[model samples]
Each structure stands twice: as structure tokens, then as C-alpha cells.
Target: MKNLIAATYAPMHPDGSLNLGMIPSYTTFLQSNSIEGAFVNGSTGDFVSLSTLERKNLIAAWAKDKPKDFFLTNHVGHTNLNEAKELAAHSQGLVDAICVLPPFYFKPKTLESLLFYCAEVAKSAPDTPFYYYHIPVLTGADFNMLDFMKLAVEQVPNFTGIKYSQYNPTDFGKCLHFDQGSKNILFGVDEQLVDSLPLGATGWVGSTYNHLAPLYYKIISSYRNGDIEQAKLLQQKGVFFVQTLDKINGFNGAGKSFMRLFGLDMGPSRYPHKTMTDKQLALALKLMEPQEIAPLFNTSFSVKHLQAIG
Candidate 1:
């Protein structure tokens, strides 16, 4: 939570089965890029598409291979309350923390009901720190997080804070200052990260961090160094990076496919998410090169190709 925590992709084989074998390499890649942790089974992992057993298996694989220092938060959210608790219980000792999105389908009508649901899931993993994944756009359960946290802290003993993914900076800023900044309110929007920094956002969880950690770190350093213009410029690159991939194919699939540029073949996107063709991928790289963004990709990419473009 101190720095960037990647919302990891679930590696799959061509057949779309869980390619858990790729996890060890995935871990090394993240650590190499200085990503603080992995937020598994979240949006980027396509968790809803994965079965309960598949989600459990994915967490187990990450836990088994993750380096001692790597922080892993298993997103054990399920529409079914029983299954969510089951996954929470399963993640007890394996992960550094456990996270749960509000059940998206039925949707919680009131903050009290949302609190009830979170408290139930949190108690299932009593010993592990619990985080409420507040992504209202997808969940359709939009509650004021600052108000919810005021109640949640009193209700749920293990409730650490929120993964505030929505675009409400005023509320996000309030949540950050709640109780003099006691809770860990991780900002979830990548494009808005630089803006969030001035609002006291220290931690972030996003999919872009997987491919562009170096660029982001540079952004952070530039901001810290008082180079505001450079920071803004770098952040715009991030925004453009996401937009470019999103244009080639849906960003979720194209971005995951872009991992191959780092030498980690994360494989095809499952149903409903388009996998980029080789030509599409080449176009993605081509699009990034002129923006001066390609140079910031991981060193694992062919230096020759990068230089040739340079």
C-alpha cells in the first residue's frame, strides 16, 4: 500500500485455462520493476469470469511463489456471500491482506447493508487485514466512502480502508484525511494519479503499473523534485499509453497482451475481452514509440528494436 500495487492479470493458456505456471515469472517481473505488491482477483484479473475454485487456485499459486517482501491482496469477492467468506477463509495465511468488492449484481442499496456485507467477509479472515474495494462504476453500489468509513471502522474490526476507484476527488481527499489520515485509502484511477498526489494519495492500485512502473516512478520522482511540468508531462504519457492500447483493442486485453514487451507472455484474454493480434500489437508499439513512451518500457524488451525506433 505504500507505493504502487498492480491489479494483476490472470495468466491463461491458449485454451483459456489458468496458466498458474507463469506466476513465478510474473512475480520476478513485478519485483524487478519495483512494484510494491499484487492485488489479485481484482478487475484486471477478470475475476468474475473465473470460477470459485479457479480464484482459490490463483491465490494459492501467487502465495506459493511470491517473494517474502511482495504484498499480495486476494480479492475474494463473490456475488454469493457464502463463497466470498469461503475465499476469505482460504486466503487467511496465504496473503498479506484480503480485499472484497461490493457484490456487483444485486448491489447494496444502503450503506448499512454494504457495511453488513463487508463486515461479514472481513470476519471470515479475522487475522488478515481487510479492504473494501469501492469501485461503484462497475458495482452500481455507490456510497460516500468517507461516511461509510466512519461507520465501518466502528463495525468491522479488521476493516483497513478502501480501494477508492471512482472519480470523486473531493470524497477521496476527505477519506484520506479521515481521523488524521489513519486509514489506507488507495487511489485506483491511473490517469488521475498525479492529481491525487496533491490530495495526499500515497498508494495506488492500477493495471497500467504492470507495464509502466518505470515511467510512473519517474513521474513520482519528478514531482518530488519539484519539477511539476515534467510530472504532468509523464502523467499525460500514462494517460496516452492507456488510450493507445484501448484503441488497438480494449485496454484490458491489449494492455495484458503488452506484457509480452516485458518478456512475460500473459496469454489471451478470456471471453468478452479481445486479444490483440500480432499486427495489432505491432501497431501498439508503433503508436507508443513516437510519444517517447516506448523508451521507458522494461529493459527486457529488445534494446535493438527500441534503438532502431529511436
Candidate 2:
């Protein structure tokens, strides 16, 4: 509910098993660094590859130590309606909100079916806020903003926000139109927050934020304080960092390696997704060492001061 600068968790273990031990440390690390929330079992967390129980366990483990004000947005999306609903019920008290993407395989369909799918999860998690995860490119369901507006007013009163990941800025703005109050539009692409923020987005949900939270906070706060140039500079730096990772085969693998390098015990990404190679690691180290972005990992840097700069 509070303005969130959230990180998408990356489930990392050598055997593709969920490492429960690393979660507490990771939560503590985020809290210590002033992160407002986390999105567990999302794309960055490899939710598609995890079993039902694995996803539930990760959420429970994180809920145990998460700070009171630090919200958790559970990504409860799947082809199975029962599975998604059950997960929504399981996450009722644990998470602040439940985010569901349209059924992936049954896509390229009508808006009616998409709304029905979202409505099921929305009704299941009546108490928790429901945020639609609108990433059509990945799911094959192209949802327009006008349809979302219609649904929000009719079926789902708990429809509090949306995680719009598509690259279209105009469509993103259409999602922000609400007569009652401001809808929480969380930008899913980490690199585009600079452009997205001024358009009325209050929160961000992205994988890279797991390691780059400090920089993100800097950019968001700068923009909020009316320093667009400063925010743009920081956001540009973030895009450059993301572009560097783009050259690599996997972002999750590269992100975990970055976390490990900075001393977080987050292990290697699960199997099928290879860990960063020596060559890739060497390039990442070089790109991340520059002072402009290096402060992300520096313990001495104050998040408030970084927000105020420029």
C-alpha cells in the first residue's frame, strides 16, 4: 500500500532447489538498506519453474522476517485457475498484495476470458489487494488499458494496481486514468523508470532492483523532489548497467553473481539457467566498478543523501 521500491527475488541454488536459508539474510539485507517491499516468486524468482509447494515455501519464509511496513507482492500466476486461487489464499495474510498474469498458454483470446481469469484470483484474495501483471509480450495476451479500467470499476474492488511491463508509454498512461483515486502503476522494466515515473507511476517491480535498490531509490526520490535531470542521469546509469547484462545470456544468473560478489550468500541460479561464465563475470566486474554506480554496494553511502543529490 505504501509507495514501494520493490525487488523481484531470484531463486538461486545449484540443484534448482529452493534455498530457504538465504531468504532471511536477503530480507534482512533489503530492510537494512531501506527497501520498502519485495515481490517474491515472480519472473525473477523463476516462478514458472517452481512447483506449487516451492512457491508457497518461499513466500512463507520471506513473510517470517519481513519488516511490518515492508510489503510483499506475491506473483500467483499460472495456467491452472485452482492453483492460482489456492496460492492467493495461502498468501492472504502473508503478503500485502497478490499479482496475477493472464493464463499464458490459453492466450490470444478475448478480453472476457482474461477478465474472468483475473476475477477468479481477485475474488479468492478478497482481503489482499490484487494487481494485474500486464506483460503481454511474454504471456501472449494483449490487454488494453480501457479494458482494465472497465474491470477495475466492476468486478474487482480489490484491484488496487497494475505492473505494466510493455514498452508502450501511451498505453501505460491510459492505465493511470482513475476517477476515484490514483491507481498504483508499478513499472516492470527497471531501465525505464526514469521515463515512467513522471507519467504517474509510484512504484517499481523489477529483478535488477534486487541489487540496484539504492540506485533506484536515488532516481525515484530525485524525480519526486523535482530534479528530473538528476533522476535521468541515475536512470541512464541504470540502463547502461542493464544493457551490460543484456549482452549476457541471463539476467537472473548475472544478478545473483553480482549479489554474491557484493557478499550476499545468494547461491547460483537454478539448473537449466547457467551461472555466469568467467568471461561474463570479468565484464560485469569492470562495468560495475565505476564510482557513478559503485555506491549501490558501498555500505557507507546514505540513501537519503543519494536521493538528494542533483
Candidate 3:
């Protein structure tokens, strides 16, 4: 969690069935490419589209005898409180942490209501550390983290941190400094990660990190060495990577398909998510080539070969 923790994609068959078999290779790929951990069954995994059993299967596969340092955080939040609690309870001995988006459908209006939802899920896995997934765009629950930190600390005993995925630096800064900087606020926006480093962010969890770990590590190194131009330039490649795919066939769908370029074919995307054609992937790769990120997509390259070159 200290560095880039990839919010991993759901591996699937052509018909969109879960493909657990890819995990062994998946683990090896992440390790070799310098990805520290995974945030499993999350937005990147299309958690909302998955059934309870499907989600359970995903957690089970990822949690089963994983490498000791290959941390797994399960996103067990569900619209149905009972189902969420069940997932939370089921993940007790399996994961390093559990994160939950607010119940987006009905939505929590007050601070207490949000805490109540989190408390229930937290109670189910009392031994586990609880991280509130604070992606306001998706959840529509825009409760201020500064407020959440105060309330969560008082009530949720295992309230460890937040998967902060918004653009509001003011609230993010407040949460980061809450209780003298004890909180673990894992930044979630891949495009804006460089902005967080100056704000004292140490950990990040994001979807693009799955494909661009070497690039991000390079961005971190560049920024730390007072190389702002290099850092910004690297980040723009990610921004372009996302923005370009988003235009052609939606980022999630095309991006999932783009994993094939990285030696991990995640299969076709699910409903409301389209699969990118080979032609589309070719177009995407063409754009990435100039940025020098195209070569790092495949695992055939060695770790020694992965020197960041953007």
C-alpha cells in the first residue's frame, strides 16, 4: 500500500465469465512489474455488475494463499446492507482490508447515516481494518472527509482510512492531517497522483497502476528529485491513456480489453461496458508508443528492462 496498489480488473472468459485461472500469472505479472498489492473486486472489477456469488468467488480466488506481501483489499460494499455484511464477514481471514462505497442508490444524506452503514459492515469484520471508499462521483455521497474522520474515529473502532478518489484537495488535505497524520488515506485518482505527493501522500490505489506501475514509479522518483517537468510529462501520458480510451469505447471496456496488450487479457467487458476491437486497441497503442508506455504493457520484458523512459 505504500506505493502503487493496483485496483485490479476482473479476469473473464469471452462470454464474460470469471476466469480465476489467470490469477497465478496475474500475481507474477504484478510482482515483476513492481506493483505492491491489489484492491480487488472494486469499481475497476465492475463490482456493481457482479452477483453476490460472483463477487464472493472473486474474493476467494484472490485471497487464497496469496504471496505474503501481495496485499488484498476487498471492496465488499453492496446496495443491500445484508449482502455487504455477508461479504465483509466472509472476507475476515482472507484480506488485508475491506473498503465500501456508500449505498449509492438510496444514498446517505446525513453524516450519521453514512457512519451507520459503515459501522454495520465494520462490525461484520471487527478484526479487519475498514476503509471507506470515498469516490463521490460514483457514490453521490459527498460527505466531507474532515467530517467523516471526526465521526468515524468516534464510532467505527476499526476505521483505518479512506480510498480517496476525488479532486477536492482541501478536504483531502484535512483528512490526511487528521489526528496528526495517523490516517492512511490511499489516493485513488491515477491521473492526479502527482498532485497528492506534495500534500504528503505515501500510498495510492488506482486502476491504471495495473498497466502503468513502472511509469508511476518513475513519476514518483522524478518528483522527489525535483524533476517537475519529467513528473508532469509522465502523468500526462496516463491522462492521455485514460482520456483517449474514454473517447473511443468507454475507458472501462476498452481499458479492460487493453490489458491484452499487457499479456493479461481480461476478456470482454460486461453490460454497459463494450469490448474494444483489435483495430481500436491498435489505435490506442499507436498513441501510447510516442509516450514510451507501449513497451511496458507486455510482461515478456524483464524487470531490468523496465527502466522508465518517458
The candidate maximizing lDDT is 1
Q: Write the per-residue lDDT of candidate 2 for residues 22-89, one digit (tens) a residue.
A: 87767766777666788888777778878999999989988888777788889999889999999999
Q: Is candidate 2 or candidate 3 better by TM-score?
A: 3
User: By the lDDT metric, which is better: model 2 or model 3?
Assistant: 3
User: Which regions of candidate 2 deviate over 4 angstroms?
Assistant: 2-4, 277-279, 289-291, 298-310
Clashing pairs in 3: none
Full ranking by TM-score: 1, 3, 2
Q: What is the C-alpha lDDT of each candidate?
A: 0.90, 0.75, 0.87
Model 3 Cα lDDT, one tens digit per residue, 159-216: 9999999978888988999999888998999999999988888899998887778888
* Candidate 1 error regions (>4 Å): 303-310
Best by TM-score: 1
Q: Write the per-residue lDDT of candidate 1 for residues 149-199, one digit (tens) a residue.
A: 999989999988789998898999999999999999999999878888888
